[model samples]
Target: MSKKNRKFLATTVTAAAVAAVLAPSVSADELKFTDVSDTYADAVNFLVGNGITKGVEDTKFGTHQNITRVDAAVLVARALGFDENGKYKDAGFTDVPDRAKWAVNALVQNNVVDGLSTTKFGSYDNLTRGQTAKLLANAAKLPVNDGVTKTKFTDVNENFAKYVDALVREGVTKGKEETKFGANDAVKRGELALFLDRAKEHFGFFDLFVMHTNDTHAKADMGPKRATAVKELRSEHKNNLLVDAGDVFSGTLYFNEFQGAADLQMMNYMGYDAMTFGNHEFDLGSSEEGHKALASFVKNAKFPMLSANLDFSKDELFIGLQNNRYTSDYSNGIYDGIVVDVNGEEVGIFGLTTEETPTISSTGEVQFANYVEKAKEAVAAFEARGVDKIIALTHLGYNDSLNFDNDLELAKKVEGIDIIVGGHTHSELKDPVVSNEFDAPTIIVQAGTQSKYLGTLNAVFNEDGVVTSFGGELVKVGDFEADAKAEEILAPYKKKVDELMNQSTGVSTEVALDGGRDSNNEGNSSVRHNETNLGNLITDGMLATAKTINDKTTIAMQNGGGIRASIDEGDITVGEVMTVLPFGNALAIMELKGSEIKAALEHSVSADLRDDKTGLKESGAFLHVSGLKFEYDSSKPAGERVTKVEVSEGDKFVALDDAKTYFVATNTFTAAGGDGYDMFGKAYADGRVSEPGNVDYQMFIDYLNVLDKVAPAVEGRIVDVNPAAAKTVAE
Candidate 1:
């Protein structure tokens, strides 16, 4: 065969025996076109990549363009990669143009198709959908229905019935309407691609391996162990994707000292394929520098980050980094979704942060769209690009905040997602939890937080891109020995952290800082449901810090959940401070009406579940206040429990005016409505919240320095009016 004859289509195609690593498009070229609507993306990509034309232009498919009879023969003959049995010097038709003679003759000699007539090839006549289907059926040698002459489609005639049924049997065309085949309509360039692509046969099961992690936080010290696991997993599977779901941000002294720089370096060393934003990724957004650390992390990343529901357009720092398209040809940066090529098969991955980020963390101007809406859009986008096997890399938590959003809810709501790698709730799913029980399975997996485990999913997708079998497990990072290079990369960062961990902040204390919790649910603190000296000290520091930011700032409150651990009655070390306020919460000041304050104070004491021992309700939301006092009836209901509230002036306390507006300071968590503080949530939504970025621990340390001796006592600022509740506390 001459070079042009061989160019009829592509070289010999082989059936692929892939384990998650499927065959590539013939000639290994990336399909480049966008005008073709997503409705035809899969079929267009299939034939254009492997069978049909290489697009009308370099970047255009011109799907709406017309194709003549001779033109269709030329394409189908080439696309079929027909084996020529006839050495036709001419097609023996007078009207057949020399340019189309060889292709028409090739199809005729093979008995695959013929001209409209022997005298004329109808070179300029357009091909209809039925005619195209018959030609494709013959080219693919689809079995003719034996003696059967009817089709399920209403408009399909007896002549085209068998051909249309054959196409449908192969999952090719589903007709224009379910019951109607638009058999006589002109076959567009796109339809031609789809029919031909879907008509081709595929056999055998394909295997895929996905390695994922979520909520790893800044435990860079575990990098060596995780690196070992990652290397081992990738080495075992030729086709694999290594991804982190999110929260590679705050947790330890590493994040506190180096921000995200250290974690990014470790992630790069481990060769992360992709990552997504966690609510904590936006923790630095309220800082004075305004998401600078997070932005820098994205820019320096070796892999792309994804978030379909996140809109970084309003945040100038992330403007150019975000490519608002789902595509198979991806690059390093951020995108709504990406189709990664793994061992020849394409896998689509998108991301979603919890919509509560603005309330749960300091998310500044970066915005979040609805997850379900963006998720559907992502699935459609990937499908258009001919990619199945979609993975939703999410930080929405596992079955968390059900009233809002979570992985379980996401799995139930969205349809096409094959797997969900999630975090936020830090659930350790030992086995794969399957959703869409009645439909296609969506396997959900989450590794426990702080780099403790590496989640691995080995799944097999059948010909039609359906998961036939899957197994998943969380591989403990501690089980593996450290990788030499990982340790080498980690040494300097660990050394820096070690140097700071034990260092005294020069804040002397005569009494221990009581970051204490009552016995009920051991970590549940009295500082939560009532005032503690530690809460007072922290609140005093926050109030002081707020005053520095704004002189009018008077009241400061700290949530008990934000306080993690206690300090001893000795010299204060950097480590203890971090342990207590490890989340790196900044100061967020919001203006609230006195009515709203009373409502919030009500929520603070409204815990209905009382501790068996203390007879006090266990609540993480208990407020530790400075420059404020409140009395609440614990026996009363949630929204109406606060009896009286007062604000402190310089020398005297004044009853809180219900309509007066006041500036109150707290950690970013509460300011953003972290712990069911609806008033603050409303305040944040109303644009009354301002994050001054005062590091809470730093403020506490500064206050400790000013006090010369740290012996803070609870001063009865918050009192429960219930007599029995008071007696239980005394007991």
Candidate 2:
């Protein structure tokens, strides 16, 4: 009844085959229709498989048998869900040769059939094409144009003209030939099966099958598993789409060496229908080439990448390859959105990225518009195209902060979106979540990170273009075997990666670097809660790197979660440093007030828990400092935890002044509020941050080269007054 729901429900009818495709498939082998050829067998299988008809015999379907008027009534009744329970007078039934008496009665009771005379039901005569049209039109309750005396069909008389016009208007048939109806000709059994099937789609039922993934951050090794799953699932659904939400770049050595080429190959081979650009997709936008790698990835992708709110026109690398509006005719290019026709259903798809892209990633000149405004415009454009079922492939986090642009807020603000396949936060939505934000429901789904799972969603939409029934699940990639063809394609890339990981970085350590999770012989994760020598060494490297670009940058920090693995006391390989900082996070230098620094350090251990079994539980937010020393009282409350904070002035440590402003360096992830560092994000948004575009591992490697032999120690920079959660003085 609402304007949004009515835009897509008007003026269109699909063939009855839409019904068969939506329901479970029935093999042609199950039916004994030997006379039906492979080309025409689908319709016959649909009829017999759905209990709408039985063959003339057990081994044969009598494919070409003449369908009498009474037989037409029987088939139409079954297709309309009318059981033969109606009792009738001599008006239209009870005299049609017991085989079709009840069938004729049901049709007559429904006002879909009429007798030639009071005592006659036209039982023995072969049904005419014109009569078939009238029966189908009446049975399916199609709107008849009573004044339509003239139609495309020249042979149709005034009596059958309205009924034939109704069928044509609903897209039931084009006539026997395009211009001729052959109104008086006898209908064959096969022909009737096709007609009835075509008429069934007018009942206003639609089904959509979706296969989606998100936050697959360069986990290229799982390409084979994904390929196998995508291929199998694509074949299983008739009306389907294969889509990804975003974040397909960064995270592993595959991206480090290949620069999204390897991931693009796998995506193209696996057949992605559409994709959206995640923020990390533009990670190299600040490099010398300025988005050259991202441009190549876009140029080579076999599928269209949708981006409704982002603009790349200013960048020469994306010239002629990107468009600014929504379209129905989509190919391999970037557009605001695209219209996909799935089994005669018009599904409008668009993409939305977080507005925080500029502050977060190395987006360079590529501008990001407000997500909510663009999303509304996209839905309006889709509505103008008469497409009701809309899908938004998004990189906006699923449940990010309400103040930020997230999928929940988008769904709540937008009026007509039916499905939202999202990413960015990397949430593994085991089940679909619905937002009843408007008159219609919007179903949101996200596949977990690293290509570990594939999301499958099956939904049933009503004539109003609203989802009435839905189900979704995450399929574990590890459960399936690797596809052979994909493995063959991946072999060369894997070899190159193995060789790169094994290549030495020309730097060695005297003792173990102690990047391990546990610092003491206790359960506390050393890298996260208690500082280690490796943390100190890594931060020292960041500070050294940042100062080379901006001498004002005096302090450097690293999030505990960013340090993944430790190194042994030996020659460090390129792979060893890469393993430690696998995210490919770039260096970000931010100018912050000393008070803001204290707030950030406090939030670092705000959630630290001391469990009886795990000893002290620290979150990934714990910070490893480089040019400063901070002390916290773990026994005190969170906001009041930090006891004292000071900055190192060459050889002397001076107490940090509350009003002083200082420059600090950290990874791009943390500078953008990653791991709950909102203070850094606030500063970055205020334009106090500068990204030198130096990759984190490359900086570490550079620092390692300068040091030659690493021997760094945690010299009481971060201390805890409460001895219970503190590491021993020697440690």
Q: In order, what lDDT does every prediction score? A: 0.76, 0.79
**What is candidate 1's lDDT per residue for 616-717, written digit by digit as tens?**
566889888999998877766667778888899888999999899999999766876789998897886565766544567877877888885788887889
TM-score of 1: 0.53
lDDT of 1 at 494: 92
Model 1: residue 534 alpha-carbon error in angstroms:
4.0
Q: Against the true structure, what is each candidate's TM-score?
A: 0.53, 0.64
**RMSD of model 2, in Å?**
12.8
Q: Write the per-residue lDDT of candidate 2 for residues 419-453, one digit (tens) a residue.
A: 99999766678877766546566778998777889
Clashing pairs in 1: 8-78, 20-207, 528-622
User: Against the true structure, what is every candidate's RMSD?
Assistant: 17.0, 12.8
Cα deviation at 113, candidate 2, in Å, is 12
Q: How high is the lDDT of residue 173 in model 2?
A: 72
